[model samples]
Target: MKRARLAWAIAGTLLFAALAVAAEEGKPKEKRKGPRLNPIAETMLRIDRIKAAVEGLDLNQEQQDKLAAIRDGFEAKRQAIQDKIGDLLTDEQRRIGQEKLEELKQGGALGREAYQKLEEALKLTDEQKQKMEPLGKELQELVGATLKQVMQVLTPEQREKVQQKLGMGKKGGKKGEKKKEQ
Candidate 1:
């Protein structure tokens, strides 16, 4: 819980920095540009870690195929969300746009469906779930560490620029934007 919380904090801070950067631009550019990784990217990285571990397991072809399908299914769903975010929201709205992005990250209706499918496919035994719990927690910490490292490497102005691009500051909010309920 501590690790997940820390990771989320770092990710949120990084996103805030991106939003600040975007605000610096005299006008909202069609897209805010900056060096940052969103939570979605971090989640995908954790999924990849899971995939790698699962791949090393001595499972039968059926298990392998099913797991691959599970991974692909979630990846595709994530990609779809990313595509929608880019097209649907304005550049300013996209920055500081943590609420909706987090909603998508937490998984919406589509996410629940995908998770159900993954549970079916992985056939995770109680033991497996227990083992995976710690791994998942560790992955969250690693993501947080990475975000911190990235933030440390960048300048304050650069950080703010990234935040602006993300619509995180006063200059970045849109009129119609609403906090997406998880």
Candidate 2:
């Protein structure tokens, strides 16, 4: 009887151990972080915001084609700036920059804080910072011109829709701000 009891105990222990092992094996493996993005570019953030603002607008085929043409025309200039930025960053720096941008985007940092985040992420040597300064200026100009061209293509109603989506108004306050009493 003792032998029988001992055998059952051993069998139950083995079964429990086997079940535990099988449960672990059945779970999906945790994914390991992969290679970093090739280049981390903040230029995309502004471009993306503009696109998000207008993506759902009801534009005719003609308007769509016109906007597409403008974007295509600007592509070469944008790509040149991107290439220069890519040349300036090392792989590790790109990875760090990506992490920083993701953090800032998630945090919804804007204006001064956004600029500070980029400055922090760039983390370049003085010489590299100097080289980046002009590229940064050029990128800002390109983005501004692109935005202006894009806006001009939209009808007034469509422009208002885009502006509201972008959280701006004629008053230049964000979409939600308390008006000052006269």
Candidate 3:
């Protein structure tokens, strides 16, 4: 009788453990957090950073006025690019963009390569590329102009410090590393 009770107790404990494991398995997984910022938001954040960095340069009144104008132009160009992208997207395209953005957030080279392959396969028409190219160029020009104007306002020593702050030099920054790899 004693042996039988002991066996029953052991069996009950084992069954309880199994049920606990099963219960855990049946629960839904927690969802991952989405991207913190979209592309436009990221660009704006960079612009803000540039503005902050320029504030430390101690520009003269004329240079300050020019920098302000450059910043204004940059903002306007950024908005135009945003509007153009929005106008170009259809519902289906927006869905695809969301999926791509999620994939990017996941941080896998395979995902990026797959996206590149998809773009190559699609082979956008010449007309479409032509239409998009100017918007891209305009955005780049605005950003570059802003940077140039800011650099103009700074002394050589200050410029060097700013570049260091931006991680722009040859001490194994992202661009430098990429160039080395190539």
Q: Choose the strongest candidate by lDDT.
A: 2
What tens-digit string does per-residue lDDT give for candidate 3 at 1-182?
A: 97976544333222211111222222343342332322222333345456667777767788778877876676566656655644554566445544543454355422224334223333334454445545544554566667777777667877876666554554323343323111
1-182, model 2: which lDDT tens digit per residue?
98976544433222221111222222344342331111112334455568788788998898899998887777668656556755666787667655665566578764334544554555566555545556655755776788778888889988877777765555433435524333
| Model 3 TM-score on a 0 to 1 scale | 0.44
**Highest TM-score among the candidates is held by which one?**
2
With candidate 2 superimposed using the best TM-score fit, by how many Å does residue 142's alpha carbon deviate from the native?
Answer: 1.1
Quality of model 1 by C-alpha lDDT: 0.39
Instruction: Report the poorest 10 consecutive residues by lDDT, candidate 1.
Output: 16-25
Ranking by TM-score: 2, 3, 1
- Report the Cα lDDT for candidate 3: 0.47
The 10-residue segment of model 2 with minimum total lDDT is 15-24
TM-score of each model, paired residue for residue: 0.30, 0.54, 0.44
- Each prediction's Cα lDDT score? 0.39, 0.55, 0.47
TM-score of candidate 2 against the unseen true structure: 0.54
lDDT score of residue 42 within candidate 1: 33
